[model samples]
Target: MIPSYLKDIGKEIHSNKESTKLKIICTCGCDEFKLFRKKKSREYIKLEKEYEEQFIKEFGRGFEMQSDLNGQVFVIKRNIFGKIVKKTEIKKLDIPLFKNFISVKCSSCCREYILFDENIHGYDAVIEKNQESTIVESKHYSDDSQKIEVIVYYNDDNEEENINDLSVAFGRIKIIKITNNKKITYCDFECE
Candidate 1:
């Protein structure tokens, strides 16, 4: 008869599988949401590369998307030799039913909106701080499968400024932008 310890080990293995539940991977045209597979770990990178290759072999090419900052819906086009073959717009609302998305908060007002999910996990900026003026342009993803940008202006007359993600209610961002335009513009994500 199998020993009790061996039986316990088997049970543990079974439970481990159950605990690490594998959901149906989200996709559009075979390889949507591929970036989600990437993590800041070597192991994850290797595994993702393997998965990507396997997917390419099985499902063919993936979509190349282009969208504006804070705009929902992405344009997917398949190009050969840099010529557009076919193009279509995929809206965030069009994400398949199986996957889940979270609602994001406005970075400025800290108010909430039920319009979309928080697929964009981080913010980035393009900033230029010179003796004349300080201009910043922050970018982020939206639940609408769109990349959005925001502009922040600071007074160069001040000794210095620290408008980091940690300093503002926006928290941490994945990207930021800085522009030299004197006329300041606001982030479109800000609610009225």
Candidate 2:
């Protein structure tokens, strides 16, 4: 069950017009979802302070810096001279990203989904009945601003499938050839 405070925050996130434009439906055919957004609220600030205090209590020293990398938390213990004394990697911290993003879970199926990510150029998901799978595709921009497409396959049961089972190849444009005066386009991608 979601807490009432979190539900209030979800309502605040849903009030954004741009966020509402992106629709993500669950495989169970339910469009309702619980939204969560990272924002700077009084509660958020309190949570951060509490975490820092807890870290100091456990480590017996105040951490100079804290970071979350690849779902792992790391705290840097610095000496009074501002030199790094020790760097310790700890368990995952529940701190959210400072950037703009919207996370959601299906109300009916409880399937987790990302509605929007600031780093991603585009995000979408759709169910392919013929293939008996749900196709999720996200577009990302490289350092040079080149568009890259990332695709994830999920079965009808809402479980993620292995990437090796994918039948279609991605990250390439369709090749067109003329055979006997007939145009033939190879490498057709349904989720363009």
Candidate 3:
């Protein structure tokens, strides 16, 4: 469960507003935390980076918890909110890092989350993967229908590739390699 102050932070993220304080409440009753983000005018980049590192260190590296484009992010966890709220003040609650950091629930919330199921290593691979994204054809809207926008991941190298050919046809394509146990994970899309 998100506290009032923290919920405001979420709202701020959605609105892209500048906020100074953030309050977060874990529904699991494990720990309630409050975060005070510096003003955008100040040097927030460093603070945000620190937050990411600390978050990963506390939560572990097993799952990706970042928020996605649509902001549909969540991780299931058992909560005992009854005991936690009883001991704290509802209006003025202050605590440190959330209890037992789980996984990220949003990307905008964190920005370091890996939302894709596969690990993309190049642009060609990204084009191939994003090709599967549902295509919304614009009818009677405009004639610029030859172009398509796709979301994908690529490595530091070979990040630029052509997107035109990938969406031209839809079959099955592997965009990149996924890593497991420090090894690459390969994916094959099979069309029925």
Top TM-score: which candidate number? 2
Candidate 3 lDDT over residue span 70-175, tens digit each: 7655422222552222121123223221111111222122211111222231233355554333222321222111111112212222214444332222223222
Per-residue alpha-carbon lDDT of candidate 2 for residues 1-192, written as tens digits (9 for 90 to 100): 111213222222122211121123456666555544445569888988898788777566644547665566666766679777778887656996333444556656766654333333111212222222322343221121111111222123222533322322121122222334454542222332
TM-score per candidate: 0.20, 0.25, 0.18
Pairs that clash in candidate 2 = none
Which number leads on lDDT?
2
Clashes of each: 17, 0, 10
- Full-model lDDT for every candidate: 0.28, 0.39, 0.27
Candidate 1, 164-191: lDDT as tens digits: 3211222221211223423222122321
RMSD of each: 24.3, 18.7, 24.2
Show model 3 residue runs off by greater than 4 Å.
Answer: 1-45, 64-71, 76-121, 124-163, 166-192
Question: Would you give me the overall lDDT of model 3?
Answer: 0.27
> Whole-model lDDT, candidate 1?
0.28
Residue 96 lDDT in candidate 1: 24
Better of 1 and 2 by lDDT: 2
